[model samples]
Target: MLDMLTRWYQRRFSDPHAVSLVAILLGGFLTIYFFGNLIAPLLVAIVLAYLLEWPVMQLTRLGLPRTLSVMGVLLIFAGLMVMAIFGLVPTIWHQVGNLIADVPNMFNGLQNYVSSLPERYPDFVQPHQVSTFMITLREKVLGMGESVVKGSLASLVSLATLAVYLILVPLLVFFLLKDKEEMLEMLSGLLPKNRRLTSKVGAEMNQQISNYIRGKVTEIFIVGIVSYITFAVMDLRYAVLLGVLVGFSVLIPYIGAAAVTLPVAMVGLFQWGISPEFWWLLVAYGIIQALDGNVLVPILFSEAVNLHPVAIIVAVLVFGGMWGFWGVFFAIPLATLVKAVWNALPATEPPPEEQVEE
Candidate 1:
């Protein structure tokens, strides 16, 4: 047993290219396993870099110093964030206050409506089932909201820290852009000695990843702004907020915008009372999504994320089951990683259809 194990270890360590499969598998396993803890912030940093680096690069090309370029991009994004908060927060707060004042009436109306349902046509859902679902849901979010209230002020305090992190992200992005070659060399050196092929493949993978990240960020911004503008014109409750949500959610692909639509649309329906305006709000979202799905995403994600819809969905489900929102956020990148691996393998000769099993 010891001799067999020793031989296996020797074979594994002997040839770098031969061990590629093992290394890839182990690395993937570790990334998936430790992703939420080790990867989330690093991924966030990469995203911020992609967002800021375009203007940074352009400015550099136009004769600004690289540091000055990064600084300018940082300032612009910061101003936008500040403007969004100022414009959106107070309105959302007022809506929340109004919603609180209306909740009891809404609950009473809902109970009356449900009570009428069981009486008007029996043999279906009991009131208890309805009550149970509501209880479970309230238990989840309000229970979470309790934590939110307690931590709200702390979260406000974290703004400064967040700003610091944002600042760091662009700085890191600038350095990544400025020292791209040196950084690649240093990172690639992590492979075993003489692993030239492995290092070259790894560098190629990183290049794809960088472009994908950059492209997706641009896609999100475009989708978000378009949605926000449409919603604002319709005067939807928290239009800017919901727009931000949709735009941000659009980054994740299919299910991202849908999830945002639920709470946000509910808020609109709940506050606006479902008139033509309410229906228009729903239609507005459908149109925005159509625009996004038909145009914006196709243009941006087609190259960056070449995976089929089924593959993208499966990645989201598997990753979401494993990690939740962060999983969704990372799905495209993960899919791209899968595609890189799939394409790297040599294609097998096709079997004759006649000889294949029925």
Candidate 2:
């Protein structure tokens, strides 16, 4: 066992560069695993800067100074943020408060409907079964209500942290964009001189991650705006709220859309029952989803995220378990990073067989 372990170590770590690479990877994993929350703002800033870098570069190419380009990009970003916070956020908040206030009524209606299920479908559902299911569902709903309350309290406590992130992230993004090359130089200085593999992997990851983040942000906005307009035209209640849900539903790919559909359908059912309006709303919503899956996704991610559906789903589950929302949001790019590293690393060649005299 000792001999085998020794041989394995010798075979893998014989090169000093390999040892350095292993150390770097381990150190990065540890840093992220242990202090991810603490450095979240920095990570967010980095991602935002990366997303904005293209526009900055385009401006520079058009005869603007790099500093001016960075400033222009930052100003545009700040304006959008201001619009979202002032214009969109308040409406969403108002709708959310209304939803919360209506929860009791929703629950009561659900309970009544469930209680009637056994009578409506006597052959399919039994009274006892319906009773048991309703009891369990009530408990789950109560638990969820408690969780919401706790989460709201937690958010209140984290307002200071949120404020810090809001102030620091944009500032960091500005500096990162303004001194991008200098920062790259400083980071590269820490690595071994001969780091071809590292550089290759980094470059691949940079391109993939940039495309993914930019495409996703664009998708969210387009989907949200379109959904909002569709719902408003349909005279749907809580149009903004539903549209936002539909928008962010793209984040988790297969799962988010399916999960969000229930609420949307439920809202439509409650408002219009099994009427033409309900069917029409669903048809329009379905068309949006179909177009997103078949058209928008392919266009936006044409050269980005070549992951299979299974791989993407696995990435979402694994990373989401580890880091919640951001983990889910970044699963594809992180998976791409893994794919990049795997492709960058040199494959081990099998030892040649020695021929014996016949």
Candidate 3:
């Protein structure tokens, strides 16, 4: 067993490039694990730079200087962000406050409905069972309320951090975008000279991350706008809030859509219980999801995501546990990075079994 392990290790690590690749991967993982919070602004800037790089490139192609291109793109993006902050955010926050205010009434209605379930389905649901369920649900709701209160208190500090980010992120993004090549050259100089494998992986991830970010941002806006329009047309309350939820839901693959359905259905049911309008709203939502999965996703992410459903879910759970929302958001790409590294690594195949096995 020791000999077999040694052979496996030697076969895999014999190449200098493979060793370099492993070191680079380990270093990156360690850095993120240890200092991710400390360097968050820089990381955010890097992500935004990736998102804006394409447009900068296009502008540069049009004979504009790169510095000027970066300025133009940064200003446009910042303006849109400012607009969202002042215009869209307040409405969503208002809806959120309204939802919180309505939660007690909603909970009472739910309890009343559950209490009726025993009579409606006497054989399947007993009074005790309904009582147990309601007790558990009430506890959960109260716990959620407590959590919300804690989160609200915590958000005061977060707002101050956000203010710092608002100032620092764009400056970092501007320099990162404008001095892209110079920064790359400097970073490359720091890496070991034998970095062929690292370079290969980096190139693949650079394109993968760029495509994924662009496709995702586009998906969010398209889904959000369509959902908002549908909800508004149906006179659904908190259309903007629900729309934004539906939009961001795309970030988590299978889990997100399934999770968001409850809120949409609950909102609709409470507003228009068992009515044709509620049914139509669900149908429209289903169609939108179907089209997004079958059409928009394929068109937008033709070459971006190539992972299996199981792999994707595992990535979401694992990386999300490690890094929270950003992990979930970049789960697919991170999984792809793992896959790429696995494929790129040198491996040793076991010897074939002898014919005597038959």
Candidate ordering by lDDT (highest first): 3, 2, 1
Candidate 3 local Cα displacement, residue 33, angstroms: 0.8
Candidates in order: C-alpha RMSD to true structure: 6.5, 2.7, 3.3
| Residue-by-residue lDDT tens digits, candidate 3, 1-358 | 9988877877788779989999988998778877889988998898898899999999999999999999999989889988998999999999999998888888888889889998899999999998899999989998998999999999998999999998999899999998888999999999998889889999998898999999999999999999999999999999999999999999998899999999999899888877999999899999989988889988888764467889989999998988777788888889999999888887865455478854
Colliding pairs, model 3: none
TM-scores, each model vs. reference: 0.73, 0.91, 0.94
Q: Judged by TM-score relative to the true structure, which candidate is superior, 1 or 2?
A: 2
For model 3, how big is the CA root-mean-square deviation? Answer: 3.3
Q: What's the distance in Å from true for residue 225, model 1?
A: 2.9
lDDT of each: 0.70, 0.86, 0.90
lDDT per residue, candidate 2, 1-358, as tens digits? 9977766666656556656666676788678777889899998998899789999999999999999999999999899889888998899999999888877877788788888998899999999998899889889988999999999899998999989988999899999999989999999999887676777777877888888889999999999889999999999989999999999999998899999999899888777877999999999999999999889998998754468888889989988887777789988887777777655555554354698979
Report lDDT (Cα) of residue 59, candidate 2. Answer: 97
- Estimate, for each residue in 1-358, the C-alpha lDDT of model 1 and write its tens digit: 9967766556445555536744755676668577755555555666677556667878999999886777678778879978978987787677667655666666566556655666666688777777776677657656766886878879999898778766666567557656656876896566556554455556666666666767767777787788779888887656666767787887667888778878667766666765888888889888888887787776766655367889988998987777777677767776776666545543433333486666
The alpha-carbon lDDT assigned to residue 213 of candidate 3 equals 91
Which residue runs does candidate 1 get wrong by more than 4 Å? 1-18, 21-25, 28-41, 63-68, 79-102, 119-171, 193-204, 272-275, 321-326, 347-358
